[model samples]
Target: MVEVKLHDIGEGMTEADINCYLVKPGDFVKADDPLVEVQTDKMTAEIPAPRSGVIKELLLTPGQTVKVGTTLLIMEDSSGGSKTVELQKVAEAVNSEAPQADAAVVVLDRPAEVKVPVGVSARLGRILASPYTRKVARENAVNIMEVKGTGPAGRITEEDILAFVKLRDHGGASTSEAGSEQQVPNISKYASEQEVPNVSQRASESKAPNVSEVGSEVKTAAGHETVGKSQDILPFRGRRKQIAKKMVQSIYTIPHCTHFEEIDVSELIALREEIKASGNSISATAFFIKALSIGLKEFPVFNAKLDEENESIQLLREHHIGIAVDTPEGLIVPVIRNVEQKNLKQIHDEMKRLTKLALDDKLTVQDISGGTFTISNVGPLGGSIGATPIIQHPQTALVSFHKTKKRPVATDQDEIVIRSIMNLSMAFDHRVADGATAVAFTNRFAQLIENPKLMLLELM
Candidate 1:
């Protein structure tokens, strides 16, 4: 039997949540067949089977986070009839600690199952609470099974526990003394007998509602009576949760600095129009990507990631640029590999194809991996002239492009003319690049865009 471990899916991914399992035990699968789907911070991807085999066992579950090198599934090679012989080979390959050790003697065992003990009342359908709530209930020595559920589907949520606590406190009864009410002795006679005021009575009288009674409605100044909506209480799950974690990590770990520049792109616009008039359609983003790739070649420092663990910076030779495509579901970056090697027409065609694939939800893991830099264009929607964009992690910089507008600029010593002007904003990791370097890089980029001939030469 061969065990399939989680392989590196790129973008510095160390772990992934198992979104779904496509196959079950005893099912035959072919080589390259999708075995499972995994969701990372960027995208959801299908993990394909390595070889034709019958699934022996599934080791992971949906919504469970798994790390790299963690075994996901066990498979029996159909071509190899002897399971023992195949497993021995797998053991030899996986266990590289002792090369001279005997592989046949080593045994691989399945992991043990963990059993969560349920209370007697809970098992009798008297309780409906989440695992976390049940743990809290056990810690407080409170029987959740006796507490009525106030959440959807008769599930006991955290709010229900708080409400229960309030009720217990106001009711003035211990769990042991629940069914009994103490007789009120004559206070005046008791005071006379003790010759002092009862301090316990004063303390009991001071207990009141902390805020308001449970199930009370809140009203706004607009006279709208608002009720607490359960829909607003959403679980942090899936892509949205993944994005939040990554954003926090990026902001806290990476030191970022932004540089902005405005450039006249009249020549580039003319070239685009000339091409389009010849029955060729291309997006402005494609033009910007082609220009940015050339600029990266001139300033290699901007195309790098900070290796904090190694206490060094990595400069990459490959020019794979990620284009951020906004989809209805979320934002996805589909990388175009080796942009320096492709012609402008080829780049334009690939961008068009990838953008369509992105919008249609047809992009694959291969299309989204291995980005050295990123470009996000806000020109199509016609928004702000310039704004700093957050850099996608593992990539050192991102370029934000704004809409082109016609503005008056000096054409020569004697006259002024209308030209197409746009803003280019570059946000970089300050740990890898400085302000002067960023300015120089963006200047070269603007030069290429302003002079179409220079951009064409760079493409060559």
Candidate 2:
């Protein structure tokens, strides 16, 4: 028998929450087949089989947070003939009984029965769905276990949850109406580019007045809806909890100082249009990233980490810039490595690829870690004026770019002219860099952004 333990997937993660199981006891699996999915503080990773074998038993349940090195399941080697009788007896015992409410059986053509994790209060067997799917169900106040799954191995999907919502709202629609359910709600806007969502209706409107989680809705004694201890609450686990912990640690440990500045991006915007006219389209953010890399070369102090234990500050040579992406779950920062080495086109392509991966929740640990600096662009989300952005811990500085608007400004000749002005907020660890240095750093960045062609001289 081989013990399938939860090893450290990456970034020295000590614990992870069990998401779901892909297979169950008595099911035959090949070498390197994914067995279970675990959600760490940063990413969701699957643990694969060590070798071809029969799944003996699952020792852990979904939603349980466990540490590294804990045994997740037991697998029996298929080549061992000595314990064949015992394995068969165990398998028979598992198959003979009616499916327990704690386990949901996936309908399959094969003889092996796979049991998935059940909902906390589900009395009708188990629920097979990804974490994101479950989140969508919870947000919409739908009982996930009651919804019939139409995915592989009977797994529930986002579309399935939306269909269930429409069905529930209509209260048993006719056969034709149910079949013609094509007007799906737009869920993409709910997860905006910034952490703050700009939806018309909040999740609270559909949620139960005094409910916390599903199956936990409680009514008031007087039959009047009033806010209670658990009214309109969200679960503080997974990514949300991880972000809170880090924010607290960073704010408490680092002496942060913020510097605000405005840049005239009229030239940059015109430059992008010219490039687009010539069949090359580029994002304004790509220009911002490239200009920042050049600024980091001049002011390396802001592109460094403080080693308090050794009483030294280490300036990083390579620029690994982290872009903050907001997802339905929470905020995630995926890094674009070696920005100083890559050209504008390369940077633009890599940024788009990483952002897509982040939005889809497919980012790996390698894609997020090893960041020398971080940048948050709130411009798309409509923060036009400014913000006091937080610096990622250990890194010396972080810059947030706000919306650009055409405004009148005075030129060097004392003449008024209309230019595209954008505000920026730069936060830094005051322990490592003073306000003077931070201002100088932003000045250098503003110079490159104001003059779009100035970056050509520094480009490699």
Candidate 3:
């Protein structure tokens, strides 16, 4: 028998929660096939099979937290050898490299007898659907098992669940075919009680109907309403717990000071319009990132890390900007590396790529690390005035952009004019930078953005 243990994936993680097992007992897997999915503090990763083997037993259950080196499962080597040295060698390989991110994998809920192809015997009842697919089913209050499997090897898919929901909701024949309500998993028990207001674009664009419970009543798909429980509980261990811990650490450790400012972005908006008219498209956040890079060149103090042990603040030369993206899972900040070295188009494209990866929960470790400074653009979500933004830990500063509105403003000539005004909140570690310096940095950023032509001169 070969033992598969959880090793330190990266970032000096001591433990992780087992998200799910891709393979169950008696299933044969090849080398590099993902055996289990684990959620660390920063990312979701999968441990691959070290060699071709038949799964013998899973030592840990889903949602169980195990420390590093804990034996996760037992496997019978198909090669008929169980040398400990061979296991050690393969384990080292799995530890050295970062695990690949795959969020669409499913959980092994319960065993139900399933039919297979000719010459294949019936296996235990197993539902095969991605975490995302299951989440959708839970949101719709539909039992995933009731949906027919159209995916490979009788795996249930998101579309299958949605179709099933539609059929049942519209009073179709499938409603009767679906098992009793007792079999359906309680959506409130498994899903988060707090509605995610700022979920990423992919989740926001989901075609699933809104089945969210409202004031102890849930609106079902059948155009009827049912009374829900007065309260619901959600597990606190995954990404939400990690985020809370980091936030508490940051708030308690760092002496935070926020400075608010408003800038006229009329010219920037017109410039973007002109660019679009010329058949080129770019996001406003891209402009903000590039302009920040130039500003960082002037005020490098904000793009720095503080080391209290050494009593020194190290200013980073490269601009790896972290963009805070809100996902269904939680808040994830994926970094765009070397922003100073890339042009606007490059930065825009890379930012889009990272946002999509974060929404899909496929961001690797390198994608979220090495951020010298972070920026949160909550403007699209409609916080119009200002916010006391929190600085990412160990990093010196963070800036949050709020909604832009067309407002009347006095020009240098004392004449009133309509201008696009956007408010921003900048939070910095007081131990590293004072409020005056933070103001100076935002002023420099505003200068370049207010006059889009100024950015051209700063470009290489």
Off by over 4 Å in 3: 79-114, 117-229
lDDT per residue for candidate 2 within 260-302, as digits (tens), equals: 9999899999899999999998899999999999999999998
**Per-residue C-alpha lDDT of model 3 across residues 1-460, encoded as one tens digit per residue:** 8999999887566788887666666554557867777887777777888997666788998777788999999998867654433433443343233122111111133323222221111111124455566667777867565565566544566777788887888887353354222111111211122221221222223222233423777555696777754434466777777777788989999999999999889999999999999999889999999999999999999999888899988989999999999988788899999999998899999999999988866788899988899999999998568888778887889999999998999989999999999999999999999988988999999998999888888664
RMSD of each: 20.7, 10.8, 11.2
Candidate 1 weakest ten by summed lDDT: 116-125
TM-score ranking, high to low: 3, 2, 1
lDDT of each: 0.66, 0.72, 0.72
The residue pairs found clashing in candidate 1 are none
Error of 2 at 272 (Å): 1.1
- TM-scores for every candidate against the unseen true structure: 0.60, 0.71, 0.72
Question: Judged by lDDT against the true structure, how good is candidate 3?
Answer: 0.72
Better of 1 and 2 by lDDT: 2
Q: Which pairs of residues have clashing backbones in candidate 2?
A: none
Model 2 gets an lDDT of 0.72
lDDT of 1 by residue, 1-460 (tens): 7898888887567787776565555444557756776766666666788997767788997667788788999988767666535544444443243232111111234322211112111111123344345434544445554454555434556665566677676884343332111111121211122222221121122111123243446566697776862222343555556667777787777788889899888888788898899998766677777778888888998888778898988888889999988874467889999998888788889988998887755677789888899998888789688886888887899999988899888856868889889988889999888999999988888887888677667634
